[model samples]
Target: MTSAPQLLTDPFLQLPTATSVQVVWFTEFAGVNHIVTYGENLKQTARASTTKLSRTREDQQSRVASQNQDGQVYQKPVQRDIWRHEAEVTGLTPGVRVNYRVTSVQEDGKSVDSDVFSLAATPKSDTPLKILLTSDHQLKPMTAANLQKVVETVGRVDGVWFAGDLVNVSDRASEWFDDNGGGALFPGLQGRAKHEMTHNGVKTIYTGGQIIQHAPMFTCIGNHEVMGRFARTGSLNDEFDDTIPRVVAQRIYPDKSLIDNSFNTNTYEEIFSLPKSKEGEKRYYAVSFGDTRLVVLYATNMWRTPKLDGKFKGRYREAEKDLNNPENWGYGQVIYEPIAKGSKQYNWLESELNSPEFQQAKYKVVMFHHPPHTLGDNIVPAYTEPVQIIERDSDNIKAVRYEYPKDADYIIRDVVPILEAANVQLVFYGHSHLWNRFVSPSGMHFLETSNVGNTYGAAWGDRKREVPIGYQEDYVKLGDPNGLEPIVPTIAPLLGEDGKPMPYIASNDITVFSIFDTGTGTVSSYRFDTRKPDSEVLKFDEFKLKLSSLPLPPGNKFPG
Candidate 1:
């Protein structure tokens, strides 16, 4: 019998390129040497240990829940230092089977080897491509089932793109590593973790299935992935102090510098090596796979919220009246970035959009955390521009403070025009957790399929909430009570052969995901009822994408 390495987490694939793929794993100790051996089979292989860097999270803690002797659940804060190792294996033959494993040497020089895994590089440009698109998997009861179903429905996916909210709290190590509650993220992604969920006193165990171990995984930044640091250390570990940045920022922003100074998404920046632009660590990037080009945008404000946190009495603090120092100012400011002209992200995106690689590709798709258009409650805050300046109680018990924005949100005022001009066929986003699609006046497709986890309810028809006081007219002028415009008429209520809307495919409780197959030029939407474990993965909606029909620049090659 052979013993596996003392691995904290199983090896997962990240940043797969044309000739190399970065493999990452974690252990308990620093200074431990690790190597990744790769080849066509497990028997013959090449080894690489060319890079090693140690990371420590002293100011952060991982929070999880555990039951007491009396069966009462409470959060357990683990503040252990983490040591992660990443090794990039190069010189691989594209579109061919490759086997690999990670071996680590302990302080005593004893070597530990992980289980062997297999994968192939991303397919070449001329080959057909299959990609899984989903987002907002923040440890919901059904997240494990969502990733497992991806593999069950689509046998082999070239890549997986998560549109943000990967974890509930970016800085909580346990939420990412080992939350005892149903939300442990790593366990769900690697197929090694199961969630014990209790619904109405009925306990059920959910076994997570593998997804990233075999294919590369990529993600963008979401509001949940941002955190604010203040006061003492361990007390501010979870989403308690985290949500303050977002919810508070909604009402105040003393100055522009305060936004970036107070909130940070550095935790997400530390774990993965995402492709970046000339400006280092910019969350957005672009890459080409097969015949299509993907442009990822990180256009989300973690501190931007439409309302205050009502869960805890002290959660919304109005401790400061002047709002000068962030430490003294307790919640009520919308943390955001200006993505209009002259912004770094805007410049890089414009370059990517006009690049030869992007314009020449058969398909151009852009992914971001916020939905430029949505049929959900989130769209209200997402689309609203600040209009007045007044102040109220932090807990929403009082009237409110209103400060009008000097300009419109960059996405609505600027980004839309750029994307429409570039002829970007599809704009994929997921902040509002529902399944819906909209087409602009110029035939550009806008799709939101974030129903991968639990939904925040639909923002359409009867499900819409009353517009906040003083905003009714604004919403009515925008489109509807929820601010959603006309959905593509054909798929409004996607029907089955029975001519009825697909059963259990509504916004809430219905876990959903989508796959784009470049080979067939089709996008298929699948959904499952999280409440029913026996629910089948049903295809609810699909659309064929004809590159020739979509408007493209005049001087581009059309691959038939």
Candidate 2:
């Protein structure tokens, strides 16, 4: 007998507040009713039913056309509905553990009850808050083990701030749902799934200690969340990476009716219900908890390279091609929203940074996907058009190097100054999947510890030190070609007490995560070395930030 549709994952928490919190889960059954009962004890009392959001596909002709052996063309609509349910429980006391149970009725009329789970509401001011910071865990082999370590080390955390790239492909249901290969993401986070990973010829099964069951998770959108495709098949096939099958791919996903068409974060917007400002919830938002105020920005551009090869790279729209549409033509296009000067996100960010709540908070941290001072290859801007500064091919094979322009892009020229002026404590970002830290001359701390699932290699080596043999070809550098290189942290291999360099750990294979403890004012980084069979998670680095005490800047005060 076939199994009827039922609740497939545990009720996970999101968007925690002093007085309320949201619980979300997925089910195999569509249109089935579900409810969450939460209260002061494990026995539960308060109740809230879920609001069902169903899936919808585009019109039939939208699917890509294909030919059969008989020379006839056909298309199939590959749409399947997976139910996502959410319940926002309110009026709970802050900083108190609340018990909850998720009950669901399957399509077959069978009732199911989830294991009793508990979560505390977000803490108010003066309460100790410990947060786990991580990002770019796209269902890799080490993902389960890395998260398992978070629970092993920090025990219980108030919240998790994922700095983007939750999955490699946002629209792929299997990636978020069940990957038959035994890597269902939700089950893994809930501690019900395990993935077997082999490194350096040693094999192991990795599992996470059910984390989301208690701690809430907040995320930013990365380039992977924004997909590009012309036909409906692009949405169906997880492997399709080119721009839409036709000319316009950005705004054509659901339909061609909207104007913001370069790329869309549709799947991301639907999956998570985050806190919002007047600008809505999908892109930019702010949340205040305990003594800290976090400002999350959607500051990344689409994934296009400096050189647009027809085979593997993105191209200009047919109408915007060089020959046919000079009026709308451009080459080496870098598609992204303008977040500097007079852009919507910029204005919203400025207002938020200057607000009284932000200025008065003991800690101010800004998070986004792209890093302003990363040594990774993705840090290069594809276009310097209006600015006239561009990147050129360097002597190293597969490596492209460029000098910082007199007038930088909006992020550096605009955003950084505002953040420094506002006295933002730290900036957390991920895209370069490695752990590296840099402090500007002005004492601003920029930390990238994305080595969660894996790494994209490191931006190691400088002119003085021969580039690490493995990273030489891809090593990127900044500063005048003939002058002293900037004093930035070098990506060097760790050393053993014997005074010899340890064996290299390839970038895409490292596992790491970081934590911030407000009460102790310290950030601790822990890493798991797969090479050691009985290896224990080791604390690799620790740093402390001086809490801000100065009054708000002259014009940054928000009215009561």
Candidate 3:
């Protein structure tokens, strides 16, 4: 018997062009007909194209109904059937709003419909906009509360700029569609989440903001979005942590396709329909929104366990049993894609910086996943490939370790110089889940406003990072690894236990969010303490993206 078709997520907007926008949704069964009904009277319709998700799966750890039965546990990753439907509604007038809803007809002849929502085409150049800046919402406990506060405080936003790390695991169907706890990506963003929080014996349920249903969202690739070598193991978590470099994978299995041997962002790439670069389809690209030129880059790498116990493969070394077998090595936090000097990504960025669209825009913003300046611990060990050093006692291999040279940090040594030279106004990123900002002498601003869910303690004062002792390369334990002073929040900075103003808001109970107002050229950050359910969302920091006074050097142009 064919199971009843059910809509998994409310319809959301994506890839808004000047005259059209894409409406996307998910369903459990392959429906007979799926479409978008738009306009004031909902008379017009556009048919949707449906495709099955390739690698989404569920394991014992999944929170789905089947896996929730008593004594029921999937020992291995089991494929979960999910179908994505996307319809392009074209012939829209720029800056005009229209009512829209999605409907799916089941194979059983039954139909499902979503609540009516509003949408619009890309805004005109003169149209002022407010865009939400957030990231690292890995289904953390506070994500629902954080998003709930956004709607209450800001009311409505035009767009959402997500820096990355949408969920804990990209291929987990429940994490994206319907985690029983209601922390799934779609539920949290479409006001369907049922996440609950308790304080002082008082329990409150939080439904995340109804933002994406009305506005479009643009995102970059974060470390969490990339899944490791295809599921060869029973545990999805193990496969996620088992990625090797493409070069290494090729050497081990020269006969196999790269996608089959190495890591991939297949699930992520399949979900969104964004503007593509000639070099990078959706992995990296640039888009023009209103008066702003937004350049998204793929600059994230595989994050490994920081432990050095020699029992597990980690950021610093290979596991003891796997050292002898070359195919099983983790390869020490290897980067997924190359963006160093002379690389394809770098060349594309150079062309984008010099292009008329970027140079003439009123505001220039570049976004990626890794931080170039931060007070958090993730910035340590440098943003470069790890150097391997193996120790052998006469015949047998004794130990294998990796080191990162600080001077060879690509983002700092190469990317930053080009961005600074291009007079890029803002650099937004989030790898460290904290709220902090820094300004270079050249006046470019770097902000990390990813304190949306939780935080890993910041590195300052007596607080330090977990760096291996006696390593050949010296790692900075405190402060920004690239050497820039953190900028204190302007309106209301958080105070430490010593009564001194701290430059960051790294709290699990208090969540932070930011909004960029294009009309004022200012990015404002706000925070809400979930402990106090009725507390006001306090505006903590505000900074303007000012055009630098320095001029491009004479006869010094970006090389193609």
Candidate 4:
């Protein structure tokens, strides 16, 4: 007989708060449902449940499961399931004691609740700026040790940050049990699990939703979020618009109508919506907490336009000039369209950085997906770079040189200069699937973390002084044994995109940053790992970004 869904956790991912705090809980029986009760410690606390609330992004689900001839198929259902959930309790006053609980909910309206948990809020005046970080942890997604470390760290820090590629693209229960949700997940993720399986020794991962929602999350879109590099080559297509993510989509089975709801940039704006917008812009704006101001950019989606103007003029000019050269054309791509800085986003980014309001901020923090540096990998953009810039993009792209490991460039063209000029404090990102930090000769700090879940095979420990040695090549030919490189098929299907496969390629996870308001105007960084057993953590670096009033570097090096 199958046991009903049930909560399978205790003190599962809880953290203290200065103001508003997000709470998370886990379950293994099947789906997860959270009903938090909080108020005057151990006294009267208001109650709220996950089922009653709603999300803007309307996620999508495939009508039917894909057929696999390989032996990987499970004898039972494997696609849909959501074993975790996170909820933000907004309008929370600072520095108060609050108690809470998470519940596991079922399809027939059955539910299992969590054991009680509590936290003492830090005084609003003295916000605890904390950061939990990790990089390149693919094969061991949510390893038991890693999960335990995460749980231990959250209780102390005020925020979290994810580097990139958190998990490997595997639909097997083993992988799902490890990573929260490997990249873009689809529907049916919630309905696949049953409570009785645990007794039979089912190793279900009760992560995902709870890890992110429990804290004010800042997401940096990574190559994984864009799928993989195979997407750039129209030849292969597998786009997963299911932002809830595959590992996550199967579990957090909410109402079907919410699929694709504000998913793209729209959904990002809502979940991560800050205290204010860029004057009248959408979600892309600068936020100020105490003395810290954060500027977020979407490298894959915008600001990469190849129009000829300001910063982009040079890149576009080079592409245009190389477009016709036969030998050189091999290295250039005229189809993806070089997104120049003179284009739409470039112009917007300029105004955002140059505005007096932006310049006035004390501590400027910038975030994006993709690493600016990596291990012993050589590429044209790798060597000879300045730290004054906070640019981000997919460098060392996949299937090119062994693979195109996206480095930091798109931001270099536009954001770096602007940030340097604004005396930005530091830069945070995840893409190379590694944990690395570089202090530019100019005293600016740059960090690349993303080992939260999966790193595939990308890991650089002590090889800090390494660079890409050769140029990466793409788009060779069909059946050409020398086709330069191979392509990876998209493992997860997107929600809004309903085509042969997901247009985006690669299988990775996006990074997130939690901006904490530490008194004295000093901000530190902490990265969070959301796997199981929750005891893993990357080296958490603490620093006071000394923003220089230095003029923009000569020749548009650092724009702001």
Q: Residues 159-225, candidate 1: write the lDDT tens digits.
A: 7888888887665566777766656777887777777655556666766667677778778888777
lDDT of 2 by residue, 436-483 (tens): 666666666777778777765643443121122222123234321222
Task: Looking at model 3, report the run of 10 residues with the lowest lDDT sum.
Answer: 551-560
Ranking by TM-score: 3, 1, 2, 4
Q: Summing lDDT over every window of 10 consecutive residues in candidate 4, give the lowest-scoring window.
A: 53-62
Better of 3 and 4 by TM-score: 3
TM per candidate comes to 0.81, 0.80, 0.97, 0.52
For model 2, give the RMSD to the true fold.
Answer: 7.4
Off by over 4 Å in 4: 7-34, 41-91, 104-109, 118-128, 134-147, 150-155, 168-214, 228-286, 289-291, 300-340, 354-361, 373-409, 450-544, 547-560
The TM-score obtained by model 1 is 0.81
Question: How well does candidate 2 score on lDDT at residue 288?
Answer: 86
Candidate with best TM-score: 3
lDDT of 3 at 56: 93
lDDT of 3 by residue, 253-275 (tens): 79987876789998998888788
- Candidate 1 segments exceeding 4 Å error: 1-5, 41-78, 197-204, 230-234, 237-261, 280-282, 303-335, 382-388, 391-400, 403-407, 471-473, 476-508, 548-560
What does candidate 4's lDDT look like per residue over 437-550, in tens digits?
455556666665443434433322222322222324231111111111211122222222334432111122322222234454433333443422233443333445564574
The local distance difference test score of model 3 is 0.89
lDDT of 4 at 520: 44
Clashes of 4: 104
TM-score winner between candidates 2 and 4: 2
